[model samples]
Target: MASVSVSFPKYMSHIPTRHAGHLAELCIVPRNLSLMKQGSVRELRIVRSSNQTEPLIDCTNKPSDIPLLSCSEATERLKQNREKHKGKQQFLAMYSSIYGGTVTDAAAMAIPMDDHMVHRGHGVFDTAATMNGYLYELEQHFDRIIRSASMAKIVLPFDRETIRRILLQTVSASKCIKGSLRYWISAGPGDFQLSPSGCNQPALYAIVIEDQSLFDSKGIKVVTSSIPIKPPQFATTKSVNYPPNVLSKMEAEEKGAYAAIWLDEDGFVAEGPNMNVAFVTKEKELLMPNFDKILSGCTAKRFLTLAEGLMTAGKLHGIRVDNVSVEEGKRADEMMLIGSGILVRPVVQ
Candidate 1:
């Protein structure tokens, strides 16, 4: 392979280059550099250059070198990157057992890369909504996470009361009156191996995200997902392994739908990608699929308990939790998806 001649300014000459084929490309390894394309050539601009200048070079190969960064430099770069994209949801606070405290800076809100949760997906998570400065059904959600961690064979980092207190304190620090709190329990940072035996300890992490959006009452459309449903054991646990769920959600959005519903191996209605399904029959009876093969959503269970009042008020004839066939669900008078995040969302299609 012939060497591709490329010239940079005196200050930028340190950047290494490489060659592939007739098609030329420039590969910059630093995250702080900005790429600008003009006509057929691309230019690299140093974001924090002392002279505040960009390099105009005719590049034909990718760079084999990567810049080694110090801990503070990397953290600053991450903070800069986050400043570029400000979304509607704001991360107000974070709590990490690894740090043994809480951090209000969004840049400091991160988990270790070696964590089993980040690598082998050996983690479980739960979410609670903050309503009017209070965590709604936090105890129920906390109980579910505990069950999930036990099923995943992850020991808690702290006792139940301790963890609960940490969660509340983290939320209070955020001062977010209305938002959501999400937390995770992982096997902690360890070697890149299949077994969690190398993990010295378990980890817990929590973050509070502020959402100003109101509860949307508009009904949405849904379709049957082509992705296979998770097995009963894994399905029931709210673990971090969610490739199937992610794919199902993407499949629905690709077809212009809000969400995709799943069916069990026996063809009974299972649940949505992340929510439970419930229906109101023509006889004014409330019906839902059994939780034997799917996750029992905290919000769905709470709704079922509260629905008894509707029965007493003559709004519902009865409530049943059994196998709901697809045909039966389709024939129902109304259908809704239930979960902590959504609370309850009606499905019009």
Candidate 2:
């Protein structure tokens, strides 16, 4: 078979850093069908532009007058391109794609366009962080994702042990001592239909992101969420349907607060947009909202387990999980938000 490889310029700087590389790959792939139709295999590569202000180049079509490039020429071009742009690349360090059971470079990673998660949001996702070469609470987060997948009616692509190995391998491949691992299990790629029955099996994707931002411990202000909270069924599932949560977060940012807190249907304290809330009561009690109507947070659960030592040491009188009314929470001596990302953040108001 004939082979053709093309280079694209850096048009990705304008896109948000998280999604720029993926979108750049998508934009380049569709326009190269003519070469493929000629029984030629094509590879599209992106390289940074020398002039920062100039619009980046994208390889689309080879002019008929120009001769087809040889394999060595293509390889050399890619090498030179990488050498020129290596310092500026902020793409994923590594990613695992379950469809092919392959771990790949982040720039070369792309999900199937027709996955149910892409079209209908039929998926579940969970994240764990790697700090100093250690994966924090990985098993706990994986269990939560499995529960979410069950709730979403999505079967896993691999057994739990295999998945755990793959995740650990993915992180090891990245060699990211301080980064976060985010993974998803989705109803696999199929026709873009509402029903996932047409899909053959589920898909898993994991990526290692190098985020160096330190978790802030300082107190932050939070506003009451105006967006309606999801019902207990959906709220507790941790599925991919997160429009309500997204809106709640945006509402908080728009109101000049760090995050917004949701209240259950009965006006009891529910959770932050994406975290579990806890309170330190005046009676030296540690209180968390009951998990019945909120997502059961692994970090919060671990905190509760460790806080038992506090009680034994006389630092706390008791620890209780119960329905906490908004008024009661507001009157607590201290309030905090807990999550994998934010280990603990005091809520000032």
Pick the lDDT winner. Answer: 1
lDDT of 2 by residue, 1-349 (tens): 1333433445644657567555554445445345444543344334344322222333345655666888768656665765578642234544445445544444345677789998898989999988898899899999999999999889988899988998888888788788788899999988898999998778988888777776679999999999999999899887889999999999999998999999999999999989999999999899999999999999999999999999999999999999999888878999999998789999887
Name the candidate that leads on TM-score: 1
Query: Lowest lDDT 10-mer window, candidate 2?
Result: 50-59
**Candidate 1 to truth, TM:** 0.82
Clashing pairs in 1: 18-61
Summarize candidate 1's per-residue lDDT along 1-349 as a digit string, tens digits: 2223434445654545443211123433434434443433354433344345445564545653678999999889889988998887999999999999999989899998999999999999999999899999999999999999999999999999999999999999999998999999999998889999998799999999999877887899999999999999999999999999999999999999999999999999999999999999999999999999999899999999999999999999999999999999999999999987688899998
| Clashes by residue pair, model 2 | 9-57
Q: What is the lDDT of residue 125 in candidate 1?
A: 98
